[model samples]
Target: MPYLFTCPHCQTRTEVEDEFSGQSGECVVCGRGITLPDFAPGASRPRNQAPGGSAGRRKRPAAWIAAAVVLLLIVGAGLIAIARVGGSAAQRVRQGRERMASIRNLEKIAAALNAYAADHGAYPAPAITDRRGKPLLSWRVLILPYLGEDELYDQFNLSAAWDSDKNQMQMYQTPAVFRHPNSQGWGSETAYHLVIGTGTLFPSTGPLGPKQVADGATKTLLVVEGRGASAWTEPIDIDAGATGGLINAASGVGLGGITDGGVCVVTVDGRGHFLSEATPSMTVNALITPRGGEPLPDDVLD
Candidate 1:
């Protein structure tokens, strides 16, 4: 018959043969020295033994419980770290898709401008003014026919101001090319704008023909993506006089307002280009001019 015994050092229970009674040896589980009590075949219990030998078990030590808790905490922290990294990667992918959509919108607008230029000798003026010189409509309204929005354009009262009672209703009917995919807020406002000034393409004085761009059509900037949204018909755009430095997209200023650290622009040749925010202010100024006669370095376009 086998008798049960408990190891004092490790609290492990084991069965031993009756023949090993009264013998001294090392504990099987803990490797500690221990002695077995002598047993009589007919005796109900051992001479100096407790009522229940291994029937009732002892509770685990505090050390074991603490180790289990520590292991659980480590696993939880690892899971949280994985979740955060996954969320950041997903956000980056979403931003990249929006940037591509914005670029496509700029390309479409460039195509419309080119078509308009082909019919007319020069590009549209920054704004259309009445005989008294009061601003009425923006160049955005001038290219309506080329943009396949001739019906919407015909509804505008070109004689009255863009925000006039009749035209105000049409203000909410913004064209798809003017609104960026990532832009927020209400109204038919636009994120696309033109850099208008004395030497720029869309000058306040008058529109310039392709031949007038002495710097070459591909070198002159026609339109740019700006920060804030403006009513599509409003004569609002970037002022060359105000933009004296590089503007990053994160800053919501001049050049890089729509993309990360860069801005997408359409040149007079109907091609889109992404200009880094790190581009020198002088190089940007040269690109904006129609006939400044400044020599652009080969690396400036890179």
Candidate 2:
């Protein structure tokens, strides 16, 4: 049972349960002090009790207080849950921004490569060399000047061989542009990977006649990702083959092998697209023998 009480200080009225009669509380409406007298509900009044006659009532049940406490705890828990979820969302967005920046850097590198190619006839063979004409370093090594890392590029001892005891393949990390910020530490003998094929339409390993084309050069990938890895940055012994444009293994470097012929390839066009998945069996066989032509079924393209 509940009883109404009037606050003498501010003349405010408040309702309190019978059990809380001895407790004092502040008036919500007038900021005045209020005190309750214990009273029982529907009980006979004692002769000693003054005017109201019914002062003794059963006290408020304890169950109501417990329910209130549970409600408060539930609300507090909900707030904490919301805060954690918001924090995670923010982290994901930040990572996404970093990834975008890395991709853009790759785009700029591709453009530079194109400009270099335009100046020269074909993609400059992997690297520049001396009278012996052996590759002194990877093409990625040569592109440093064009990518605005002239000082860093000069630091490399071009005369030294890759993975030799002296250099230990440090040249592979020269180009900052070669690595994506999102890459969790994967790279190569060279900062960049190279795509090789007879400069022809639908390129096949055999002689490039006037009529061959590197398949999907525009749609295929040239290089999508490079972080850091065991493969030397220079043309490292992989046979030049037509692999959906990008030289990145059909999968990705350091990420594990990409079997789907198409890794996410960033094209000379400065656009990025996922290339068709190359059949794993076909790609593996191609890696061993560059000349084998099990032309991917047209369906594979679809």
Candidate 3:
């Protein structure tokens, strides 16, 4: 079935097919990433969304900005080996290798997450808090030992806040695994962000175990490769409810993904995949929900 998709950036409309639903593609007019929409009958169409309310209707962000992503990328472990870069061929090759390395970084974090879950029976909450329930350190700090940074883990005063005098000094020593290769200019900061909010694997107040993810581990996104960098020790992450889009060039703060066309993501099963910025907002939402059990199309994750 084919339906019309409207680009929010350029306000241009085009007819597209359902096979591309939840995948990304570029707008012919302004050339921005656009996620395809599900034109199936009786499905929640974009019209039901709150007018000028992507924020008010978090669940239907795609509705507010219907048809705004671009083409799909390397789907699974194998990515499109080549991408065009403005610089010399060496730069392009270097970027390709760096993107691959960044995926490896995500895999390492996934391993650490598994190890932490294995030891504690659940993934660490977004942060570790004091007895009074005040946040003291981020999940990154809690997973230090799992990332083979045992010494760094031991030095932290778990009872103190992440920005405490003692902890602030140690922030510069963030493990290399926390940073992506292309995140060179960020300096000790990290680009990987965990998606947080209701229904997500990492809820605002939770320590969800593998058993809690009803969507199945392989279908759930564990970490998103963000384009912007933030302090590795800070507890900030993607707020799914607030961010309107995913894995695109026009994503606002906290919503942007890796450069080029694909957004690298790590699923709970410890596998890495490239999510196209054009992936339907609904499909992305379904994957973010831990136990929602939303039925996905065969091509959604394929």
Sorting all predicted structures by TM-score, with the top scorer first, yields 1, 3, 2
Give me the runs in candidate 2 sitting further than 4 Å from their true place.
1-66, 126-136, 164-173, 183-192, 195-217, 226-264, 273-302
Q: For candidate 1, lDDT tens digit of each residue in 101-147? A: 87788778878877887789887877889999888888899998988
Candidate 3 TM-score, C-alpha based: 0.67
The runs of at least 3 residues in candidate 3 whose Cα sits more than 4 Å from the true structure, single-residue gaps closed, are 1-91, 249-251
Candidate with maximal lDDT: 1
Q: Tens-digit lDDT track for model 3 on 145-228?
A: 888899998998887877889888788887889877766564668888888888888876786887788888888888887755
Most TM-score-accurate candidate: 1
**lDDT for model 2, on a 0 to 1 scale?**
0.48
lDDT of 1: 0.75
Query: Each model's C-alpha lDDT?
Result: 0.75, 0.48, 0.72
Candidate ordering by lDDT (highest first)? 1, 3, 2
**Any residue pairs clashing in model 1, and if so which?**
249-256
For each candidate in turn, the TM-score is 0.74, 0.52, 0.67
Q: Candidate 1: TM-score?
A: 0.74
